[model samples]
Each structure stands twice: as C-alpha cells, then as structure tokens.
Target: MIGLGELVNSEGEFGVDDYRACLAAKHANLERAIQEEWERPAPDQISLTALKRRRLKVKDEIVRLRTGKAIGRRLAAPA
Candidate 1:
C-alpha cells in the first residue's frame, strides 16, 4: 500500500542504473531459489509447503520495497 506521493522523491533520486542493478539482483535471487527448490521432488504436502515459503519470500521483498519507497518519498518532499 505505498502511496505515489511518498515514492516521488525516491524515483527522482534513483538513477536508471541503480534501479536496473536492484532489479537484476532481485531477479537473480528469485531464480536461484526456485531452481534450488525445483531440484527436490517431494510429496504433495511438502510441495505445498515449499511453495508457500517461496511465496512468502517474494511477498516480503515486495513489502519492503514498497515501504522503503514510501518513506523515501516523504523525506524527499518539501516541508
């Protein structure tokens, strides 16, 4: 639930290169995790558990980014 106003300042401050690097890192990490998990074959229950953990990891990162951007925007805004 990040507000656009809060992220405006962050967007202005972060260069394209910085954003690209961040995206690259995130994608690499996610791909690594999925590949590691898919390598192991398991029962249905275990499969579900693994998927849930993966989903949580992704969700956590998303939340962190959203909050960070919101805070950054507020700080960047004028008084």
Candidate 2:
C-alpha cells in the first residue's frame, strides 16, 4: 500500500499534482495488467477480481486527491 505520508516530503518537494501523476502511471499499469489477464486463453477469475479491486482503489485514491473528497457510493432508492 502506498502511504500518502511516504510520498510527501517535509520540504514540499512532491506536490499533489506530482503524486497524482505517479498514481496515474500506476493506474495505467493496472489497466494494462487487467487487460492482459482478460486476454489469456483461460483467465483466472480470482486474479481478475483482485486486479480490478486494486485498480479501483488506485482510481479512488486519485479522485480523492484531486478533489479533496472521498467518492461516495450512490445507494439505490428503496423499492
């Protein structure tokens, strides 16, 4: 897990934008991994699910950092 504090510096050398870009690279890598797994002759469902979850986490982190807010889930209306 990438900790926000680890990436940041006391001198402010790493700004939010830089951190976001780093996360962007990670996001792209995860996307490629997911696609590659999907393209296999027999994709591993477990592996795919894990990769997807990790990718989503990275995406959510990126959004939170960019917007200064956590992404909220929209609950379905009562039937």
Candidate 3:
C-alpha cells in the first residue's frame, strides 16, 4: 500500500516539501476547528475528542515526514 507521504516522482524523489505544505495546511485547518469548538458555549466532548484525535494524527504524520525527509546521514565504517 502506497502511503500519502511515500509517493515519489519518476526521478526517484517527489515533492516532499509540497506534501509537507499540504499537511501543514490541513493541520492549520484542524487547529482552527478545534479552537472554534472550544470557544462554543457548549462544546461537544465527542466531537472535540474526534477533532483532537485527527489533529494529533496529522501532527504525527507531519513529524514522521519531517524526520524522514529532512535528515542527512553519513554512512561510515566503524574503525
């Protein structure tokens, strides 16, 4: 199964940056929704919980992509 962040271009590297941007936008939207829910006179706990969970999952995906896409490692032989 191809994951959203795992899709690469024909050149062997796709727009990780672009994907990150999209995720960032979604995260922002989710955050706004959460805030709006919180500010309501009677917030729905169930709805709030679901929104928070989705936000958290999105955040985690962002972090995962960040670590995988933004890191550089030097492979060396141990002496």
lDDT at 20, model 2: 75
Worst 10 residues of 2 by lDDT: 70-79
TM-score of each: 0.39, 0.70, 0.68
Candidate achieving the largest TM-score: 2
Which tens-of-lDDT digit does each residue in 1-66 have in candidate 3?
234445455444546565666678888888999999999999999999999999899899889887
How many clashing residue pairs, candidate 1?
1
Task: Show the colliding residue pairs in model 3.
Answer: none
Root-mean-square deviation of every model: 9.9, 9.9, 8.7
Mind sharing the TM-score for model 3? Answer: 0.68
lDDT value, residue 41 of candidate 1? 80
**Residues 1-79, model 1: lDDT tens digits:** 3333433444555433344345445656656666676676853667556765765675565565656653443232323
- What number of clashing residue pairs does each candidate have, in the order they appear? 1, 0, 0
lDDT of every model, 2 decimals = 0.52, 0.75, 0.73
**Count of backbone collisions within predicted model 2:** 0
List the lowest-lDDT window of 10 residues for candidate 3. Answer: 70-79
Residue 23, candidate 2: how far off, in angstroms? 0.6
Error of 2 at 57 (Å): 0.4
- Among these predictions, the greatest lDDT belongs to 2
Whole-model lDDT, model 2? 0.75
